[model samples]
Target: MSTNTLAPVLTPERLATAYSYSSYRQLIDELQAQGKTTGLQQSAALTHYTHLNVQRMQRLDKTTQVVPELREAVQNLQQSYMWLVLTEGWCGDAAQIVPVLEAIAQASNGRFTTRYFLRDENLDLMDRYLTNGSRSIPKLVVLRVDTLQEVAQWGPRPAEAQALFLSLKSSGATHEEYAEKVHAWYARNKTQATQQELLTLVRDLA
Candidate 1:
């Protein structure tokens, strides 16, 4: 990757507060034990979702693989990068996506490091990364490690899943209906699209 010409988006102080993947996972478990979720405006529904997300993350942790294309992409990176992810425990997309990201980073042979930031606790950063003007969780902001300058980003959901979401919404599908379909899509996808898209981003960074 070439030297980033843009200003750094994250201050060192902020980056220092981000948690490792293991810490992030432990946090969710700890919070769940206390009947809590990772964000403000908590309720039984949010807590329930958090419970579901934990299971999803656990399954993904055990199953999501770093496809050869993505592994090769990371193996070829000429510069190091940091992936700062904004997420919340109740976020289904984050639950399904974060583990895949961790898997990829771990397989990357030290080419990349990933950190987790609970979205609500980092509103100042989250505000800068809105998707279609909405606060979307699981936003991955890639930075050139040396300068902390952002190279690119990927998140919220894969394009196909996003399209399904929008279609269901515009067609007046119920919230439950859309949610079921979107998550079912994630179940079938099994992280392939996520890895492929990230692979494209990694190549672009190169």
Candidate 2:
């Protein structure tokens, strides 16, 4: 299992201290208010992602549907686990993916819980699970709640979506082109791809 030696492993106590989804929502609200009064001092990427995250999160919260298999798998979980996600408000991928994770946890009926940590602030942990040495956002670190041993890790994007992204990157696509394509893929898939993958991961690990 992937482990972060430089940083302390997250315990339930530690995870509890991180932002919950509701707290994350409040944070975005505050940021939006700040942006309206004075120009957001953050990078353009960060500002744009913050706005996009609000919209994406709201849409997911309203529309995300957990598949029966996923629900059943989670419902049958014999062990307690925590999904410690490393992400940031400015990560577009995180905006699209995190809500689905939240939905899954809720469906598990307390068998699972999720917490968020900013990737930039948790560089030690992020570095331990780098996707090919890059600090990918929205890295899901699944751990057994009892022992805190790492179980499985998933991140950044689904397989098909990541493939599309790599294809565009290899072709030297512009950032706008790449992002548009990725966002379009997410829109078309509507979290189905992500749900299925997580189902498999959770089942195998469980």
Candidate 3:
């Protein structure tokens, strides 16, 4: 996890620079306006393929045992690796956090790029990311560009700990419930450790 500010105060100009940000927001807004509050299915359509990167990362771990090819690739372009998100227009998670990740990646000197994968049709690709016998969307997959392998990932959890936190605040959940869940989750996942690790990973790549 990296320690530098990973989320920034996004301005209009910065938002525009991220081509997918506005479009993604529109998709979520449209659905919400239509009374489609739980956009889980829609999110699945947009973000399922992110799991492929995870599979790729798993393979890298194994391959590096006998071959330096995988490790070499990560080491080579570690600095230019992209926070390649397999996202979609309708996903709440993608809409909210993708921008922040992009901002963080960009602040790191073009080290990250957002890439989309339509989960609706890319079922085969989506299979790579399946966990707990289910498919999920807005799966954030970080990649090492040189090796095209995944470095880290987090998602499919309840919206409380993610960018979806914005919406959960207004949803039916009480403040105490929300705070309790977030605190529990943060403790279970060791978020602070992950952030430190992320920072170290990026710096090492640099």
Per-residue lDDT for 102-141 in model 3, tens only? Answer: 4444444455666545455455555666655556665555
- Poorly placed runs, candidate 3 (over 4 Å): 1-19, 37-78, 87-99, 118-121, 144-180, 183-194, 200-206
* lDDT string, candidate 2, 1-206, tens digits: 34444434765576667888788767767877676211224676667768877899899999999999999999998888888888777778888999999999999989888878777666777897888789887899887777777778898899999999899999999988998899999999999999999998888866
Clashes of each: 0, 0, 9
Q: What is the lDDT of residue 113 in candidate 1?
A: 96
Best by lDDT: 1
Candidate 1, residues 14-105: lDDT per residue as tens digits? 89999999999999899999999898878988899999999999999898879998898898888888989999989988998999999999
- Kindly report the root-mean-square deviation of model 3 from the true structure over all alpha carbons: 14.6
- Greater lDDT among 1 and 3 belongs to 1
Who is ahead in TM-score, 2 or 3? 2
- Give the Å error, residue 195, model 3: 3.6
lDDT of each: 0.89, 0.82, 0.46
The better-scoring model by TM-score among 1 and 3 is 1
